[model samples]
Target chain A: MRASRPGMSRALVRRETIAGYLFLLPSLFFFLVFVIYPMFMCIYTSFFDSNMGKDAVDMFIGLGNYKELFQDKIFLGALKNTAIIVLVSVPTVCAFSLWVSSAIYNMKPVFTSAFRCIFYLPVVTGSVAVTVVWKWMYNNYYGIFNYLGKSVGLIDSNINWLGDPKYALWCIILILFTTSVGQPIVLYVSALGNVDQTLVEAAEVDGATKTQVFWKIKWAQIMPTTLYILIITTINSFQCFALIQLLTSGGPSHSTDTVMYYIYYTAFKLYRYGYGNAMGVVLMVIIAILSAIQYKLGQTDS
Target chain B: MTTKKSALYKIIAFVLVLILALLFTFPLYWILTGSFKTQKEINSTSPAWWPSEWTMKNYENLMGKMKAPLWEVSVPFSQYFTEDGTATVVSAGPQVPGAIRWMLNTIWMAVAAMLLTCLTSALAGYALAKKRFIGRTLIFTLIVCAMALPKQVILIPLIREMSSLKLYNTISAVIYPIVGWPFGVFLIKQFAEGIPGEIIEAARIDGAGEVKTFTTVAYPMIKPGVGALAIFTFINSWNDYFMQLIMLSSTKNLTISLGIAKMQAENSTDYGLIMAGAAFAAVPIITVFLIFQKYFTKGITMGAVKG
Candidate 1:
């Protein structure tokens, strides 16, 4: 009986090994073929001077794409635009959503959910649909913004929101702000709900002011959610592609040229696959660094 | 005094939220109403808050512009079909409105992606959570790292890869990449971890085989996670315009978002027609979203908490 018991346990372990591998097979097939292979090729192809069509052979031009990217004026401008967007959108999205969540999370469940759905509508509306509508709304000749501005006496003359470089990036940022807030608000609401109410009541009983209670207790408790919101918003802002592509097409002298849009333009339009992949690599590195920095800051804050 | 001051602050906050809500709802509202507005009404400097004369002209123009087959089904290893006792070689079917075709394609793609992602992720997640398998931690770490990487960074290579696989210009190309994304796996794993090991051991003691134990015990426990992942995948795949734009080129295969994008590009100044297209794309997805909002919210929270 004792001898058979050891053998039986060994058999069971072997069966588990087989079963575990069987469960992982389907997902691993896709992950390997689509995700892992592409990721490898993205870095590998960046070293060559590659282009489209079968006749063209990729020439090894070690660091040539990266070298050219630094000197390319358009690429530099795109990088600047990307930084501006990430800088502007991340804080505003975090603050606005935090405020909105704090205000509404305490409301009745019906009202809270209704407001949540309304804000998320723009996101669920899909980027293409949202961009098309915004294109109409920013029309120079007949848009509600111009009409409203003229009526309210905010401006002396009608302004072209998207056609001018001065307002174009900001216009993209505004639409981005609307879409970015929904997820943060949802997260913030839940985080706020999870805060220790007993401690909050204790603080209140001890004559702590509202701001004091918020800044001292609730804020620290929700630091992790805030950090997550910051990282995601930064990433989303950095990758603001569909809006720029559909609304501006990186036009008006490339004022709205983000790294994402430029990458698309280079690969698809100009067929500079290697150069585009290099830009993509740089973008990934930047996002990784920023996320790490935010994580460090979050850890210190708590 | 504090009570009165708080009451006033609450009222002010309520008003602000109400106004913000209106602003947020305006674009979708505009899409719906503008779809019904005539060109003259659309171009008027004094925009109509609500349409005075609602018409279907925009939708009519949109439908008339493009035509495709209502449906096309391929039979494996068969070239001909019998209609009225005569062998007829298969060809493209009769023409239908392009918008309808786009809608159909979008729905089919989203549903396929959702089903595939849920199935694969659930099995993988159950293993990662419950099975004491070698390299489980390594696999989980790889998935997390990949999730952090922005998807667009890999698009150029993915395009080349898909072309090499002869999957370009096909909906499957779009669907496969989305399934390959590991967020669903991560999410389902989080939920699967909550399943008690005692129950699973009990099932094993009862002589249930591996697959049988999973189907009977693990699956029932992870059904909510699967539901969350399904709705999340469906909504995300439906809205994934960038991938659809890159992968699909043929008019008949265009998803609704891509169709609207092309329409807007061609008719840059035709707000009415664009709005009609946008409305068509937005309404169905929004309806799906409204119905499954609970599951979607749960998915987001669950993913974030574990993330």
Candidate 2:
């Protein structure tokens, strides 16, 4: 009986393993077809120069695409633009998101719940309609903002909002910052919920003020979420494209031309699939490196 | 003394929160009011802070303009023109039929994509979460890695592939890529972990098959998760413009975003009509959010908490 029992258990384990693989088949298949194959194809196609013209032959160019990218001023401009947005926006947004989240965490349930909903509405409402409305409101000559500013004596006259090369990128940055409350807010709130109530009460008993409690106890407890928000915000800031296209299509002089946008423009508009793929490879490397560094930092911090 | 200090802090916090709240709320208020105002009123040098006459003219004009499309099947083509030699652009009323058709197309595509995503994610997530097998960790790692690869990197190859398959300019082309999302499976798997193993085990011991247990116990436990996933998947598919724009070349297959964009670009100066279309496009999503706010919160909270 004991020998039979051991054999039966092994059979059951084998059956379970088979069943698990069976369940995983569909996802694995799709991933292979849709993700893995395409990724390989992207790399493969990058070596051959492509033109939209039917008569042209695809010339095999070894590292020629990469070499051309070094000299491509448009590609370099996009790289610079992406870096500027990420460097300027991520830190400020992360700080504000954390602070606002903490403040809301302290408020009463009714008030805080309403605030959460209002803030998250933007995530669902990032439509061209909203963008258009904002564009109208940011109008240089007749904008509500300019009108209000003049009424309050903050400016002498209409400040061209989306027209100027300098202001165009900044305008996009401001809009993006405002619309991106969903992830950071949700992270802070969830992290706040997991905080040990006992520790908080003990700190209170020791007469720790709210600020001190937040900085000393709550912040430290929520470090993982903070780190997560920082990494995601950094990754996201690097991928800004839609609003740039809508509000200003890489602007008066391609000042707002982000790397991803440049890739899209290059591949679709310019019909240089090989060159675009080379840029894609570079972008992937940058993202991978940044993610690795963030992971290391997170491991150390923890 | 402590009471007085606490009171002071409370006052400061209240003022700060109120200011922030007002700042956020003001733009929405401005837009809502702007929607009500006439173009002349909206463009006036000293714009009216509030509509003095309070005409429903904007809504009326939008609705009247929007009607020509629905009636196009009944109305003769020549009836669209006026008696004068001049072309009456307003008589035809700006292709409202096309806009309605695009809205339907968008909704249908989103529904199909969401259904496909849910089926695959649920099964895959359940397997990953509950079953112990070799290569499970590797699969999890791959999914995470896939999340890091932005859609831009893949669009070129995907477009090329779609064109080769003759699926370019079709709704299926837009939705097929979205159905295979790694994020959906990751999210569903995370939620599935919260389900106790005992229930599944009990069901199995009670002579219920694996598929049966999945249908009954596992499905009920993950119903909230399914709801959350549906909303998110729908929204993502609906709002996605870049992929659809590249894949869809024909007007017949254009989704709402692409359609509206085309309209605006083609008729560059038709501000009123474009606003109307934008308003129409925004309604479905806003309604969905309001109705399913709790699910959205749950999905977002769960995803963020895990991250």
The numbered model that scores best in DockQ is 1
DockQ of 1: 0.55
lDDT, candidate 1, at B3: 88
**Runs of candidate 2 exceeding 4 Å displacement:** A1-14, A52-56, B53-96, B132-137, B194-199
lDDT by residue for model 1 over B92-118, one digit each (tens)? Answer: 678988999999999999999999999
TM-score of each: 0.95, 0.88
lDDT per residue as tens, model 2, B1-307: 8789977877787678667767665555555566566777776767677766555665555444322232112223322354532223343324455667678778889999999888888888888888776678888888898887776688788887875565667687788788776887888888889889888889999999878988998888777777778877898898887888788866656777877677666744444455566666776877888787777777766666543
Candidate 1 regions exceeding 4 Å error are A1-9, B75-91
Worst 10-residue stretch by lDDT in candidate 2 chain B? B66-75
Q: Model 1 misses residue B265 by how many Å?
A: 0.8
lDDT of 2 by residue, A57-114 (tens): 8789988998999899988999998998888888888887776776677678887777
